[model samples]
Target: MRDSLSLWFIVKNYRIRSVFIKNFFIILSLILLPVTGFSVGIYQLYSKTVTEEISSAHLHSLSRIRDMIDMTIREADNYSIRIASSETLATLMSPSPMHNYDLNVNVLKMSAELNMMDTMRNFVESVYVYSEQNRSVISSQMGRWDLEQFLDQGWLDSYNTNKSQRKAWTVARKAKTFQSESEEKTLITLFRLAPLLETSKLGSVIINIDTARFMNMINQTGSDYIDSVFIIGGDGTILGSNDLTLINRPISDVIPVKDIAEGKPNEPVFVYEDESKQSVSYVHSLYNDWKFVSIAPLKLYEDKAKYIRNYLYISSLFSIVVALIISLVVSWRMYMPIKQIMSVVSRPGEWLEESPPPKRVNEIKYITSSILDSYGEKRELENELRYRLSLLDRAYAIALQSQINPHFLYNTLETINWQAIRLSGGENVVSDMISSLSQLLRFSLEGEDNLVPIRVEIEHCKHYIDIQKIRYPRKVDVQWHLDEKIMNYKIPRITLQPLIENSIYHGIRPMSQEGMITISGQLEGDSIVIRVADNGVGADPDKIERINQELADKNWITANNHIGIRNVNQRIKLTFGDQYGLHMASVPGHGTTVTVRISAIQA
Candidate 1:
């Protein structure tokens, strides 16, 4: 019972069902848009927050490494100044040859003190003193040697190259203090002129630092986030770096010098290399003007936001799936009612599909077409019924006009015709007129059908003309120029008689001389045209205009003077349609012409 009621309700409201699926999708989009936007917004916010946090932490670590490197180099510079000013080193470097015993004691004391100083700092590789006047060298690790025999000649060359400076640090270079050493050691030596108070420079004190040990100290201050580190001199030279091959080279060769120059004193800058991006952070040292730099991969910073990005992807996919399911379920529920209505209204073989169908077979369109077709059929039936009723009314009106004892009038006319023939003792004009009158009355009263053959209508018109000829005597003549093919065509009964009547009474009767009435029939396309013309004094232009206007406007009620012509025009249009009707034309002294047009219907 519930199913039946549901079906009944659905069938009754099937007119509005087409918009259900369209509206469902609209609502689904409204719901899903916000869900998708919110998920994306949350992911972007979280990713931005995480990236900033990681960049801040990495920058702080780089700053700590910079401070550590600066302090170490400051300590090395202070100690190098102390050794250069020592009296024992200055006396040993004098040009005068010292007594062998005193020279040996002074060298022993200086070597012991240098060795102790080298041991104080883990980054310091060795310490030595060179006597330019004696051409001798003293080392903290090795005892003494003549300048030519000493294996570590790189420092002497470096010191000689920049002798004008009171103190300076050389670029990284290889050194060997002993002949038996298999491999050269990489060093950055600090050279200072001896005897700080004297203007005459005799010799120099040197401090050799191991590049590897220096870099190891820098590495200790760093974290895994850093890809590499370097200590760059003010002249753009890489004075210290974890990669030994990069040491002593221009820092601009490995990183763009412009990028570093663009950064503020202590800040991070980003640079892109072919396929990867790196973040470079550095701090400038106030003591030596050297830059402490750290390079880290940018991908590592973005990795911290991966969790939020993954959640966004998952949430977006889930939301899309859920929205699709909800839209489909809702649309299908609404569409089921329309589908049921389609099945009930359509023919037995024409059921709507449950799945999406083609445009022509859509449930709503099919139902709409069915309803429109039914309405058209109903309207057509009503029009036909009204047309028949109108014809019956006209027939009844005609019957009323002839209702003065129609049978008795017919009998009286026949009796008069027979008596006139007997009184004349033969067929005379009076008897002929009586016979024509009887035939006209019987044709009008007895015929019930609205349409008659052209031959029959033409015969009735001749009877009217015969009576008119007897009344006018020798004043009127009639002629028929008709086509043989039009004789079989059907026309409204007594159609041509009224046209002839109008021409005789209104056109020929008013003339002083004998008049001629001519009737002609011809085929024009699908219609048959009949023209009735009379040679007499025609009507005035105004009267002709008024009569034609009445016919055109279907003004049947107001047209009393030309009622016969108007009635004939009305009947032809009602029978064959508006396109078939009568048109009148006249001239002041010439005859009048009435043209009758009707569809060629041959039965």
Candidate 2:
């Protein structure tokens, strides 16, 4: 009893069934999107929050680092100012002849100034005064060290900047003087240009700070999340790095310099994410073309939000699952009527695939009735189209038969020509005329096929022109420039004969002078071109254009006589393709040239 009741409910009228299911689904969908979308939206919001936090934190830490870097550079600049202003150091470095006592006095004066400068700054490992005048190296600690041991000639050229008087930075190099073999010390040099005093040379001052100390000062300002820190010098090389191993490496080696150059300058921080490494960056421009770039792992900040996302996801999953189950139950109930309708639609000629029939409703009956009516109308239309097409085929056959029938006309012509040949008593003109006439009739009545070999087609045209020759004698002449090699190519039967006829009646007959027709053939790559041009009374340019337009456009309004040219054009195109057709070219008082183009298909 319960099974019967359930069946009855399912097989209820379609209008009521569709309305109930549609409203139910509408309510169900309204419930599902918000719940699912809210969960996803919440997750995205949290993700954005996490990204912003990392970026904010990155900029903040770099700001601190920037402050520290600025302080160090300012202090170094102050040191440079002091060194530049030293009168005793300047006088000692200036060019002069130095005897033993004079050299000693000058050396002592330079040493005292360096010692004072050294006491004022703690970061400087040593300050060297390279003098061009005396060609000597002077330092704060050692009065004189071998110039080669402390500073190479290469260092002079390597660190030379275009501009002078400003402090310049260099990539880390092996500390020249103070280093133990157990731990190699790398130094980043800061060079201060010694000012010119009375056009005397004071050379320059070089300050070397151990790279470990220089990088430490920059790294210490950043937060614990920072994965790597770099100090890139103006020369595009890494000057100092927290990872001592990366010192002296070009900025291009870590990140593409092109990417850096094109980066948004106004962006507080730049984030680079890839499979190999993910990090947020902060770039702070320092004085003298130095950039402090810090890359901190993005995963660190992302991990901070992971637990929150996971907990929220777990909570939302249960609600989605419950809603999904409810949706499935409602959707399954809605699918029955839709499935039945689709079964009929997917197959065009067939209707139902069921063995035991399902119950039908008034809506189903109406739909089936409408579909049957449409199907019946389509069948009737198809039958009518077939009937009309059959009539068209018969009409074409009758028309073709009228042109070249093997019965009454062709047979009678052949009989008369044979009689004339027999009775001519070896008269060449009568025999030749009968021979051409009989051959032309036979060629015409040969078969129903449209295409014929080029030789056969040419012979047919020659035959037709021969008959015209008998009528007019030397009034018209045909100049054949056909290439014997391409003479075997197949073209539409009767193709050339009609074109020659048009030239004669329309062109040659209208002119006062003797008419000449030129027919030529050549292999033009993949196509055959046959020209039937006449030296007849030329046509008006505008009339020629109108005729060409009509021939070009099949649907153009045209007179009955234009049909021959238009038919030839359409036939060639239909036989070969649209690319091959007839073209008419003419000039006033010159002539008209009608060229037939078709595929060069040799038999």
Separate clash counts for every candidate: 0, 0
For each candidate, the alpha-carbon lDDT, in order, equals 0.77, 0.69
Each candidate's TM vs. the true structure?
Answer: 0.57, 0.48
Per residue, candidate 1 scores C-alpha lDDT tens digits across 34-107 of 99788878777775665565557668888888777767777777776777778887888777768999999999
Highest TM-score: which candidate? 1
lDDT tens readout by residue for model 2, 1-603: 234223345447454465445655675777777987887888888877876777677767876777777777677666765765677567666665658787778778877767675433555666677775566777877786556666434346644542253444444676555434455567777666665343433577767676777666666656875767777776767877877787788877876535444465324444456643345464656655677777767776567567767877787788767776776577666665555455445442465323223366477655654565576677788997897577557546655656654456667766776777678755467667767877877786677787888998998999989988997777789999998888888998778888888888878887777799999888888988888898877789889888777667633322343337776786676688767888888876677899888898977
Winning model by lDDT: 1
Worst 10 residues of 2 by lDDT: 554-563
- Which TM-score value belongs to model 1? 0.57
- Off-target runs (Cα >4 Å) in candidate 2 are 7-28, 116-122, 146-154, 159-171, 179-184, 196-200, 257-259, 266-277, 324-603
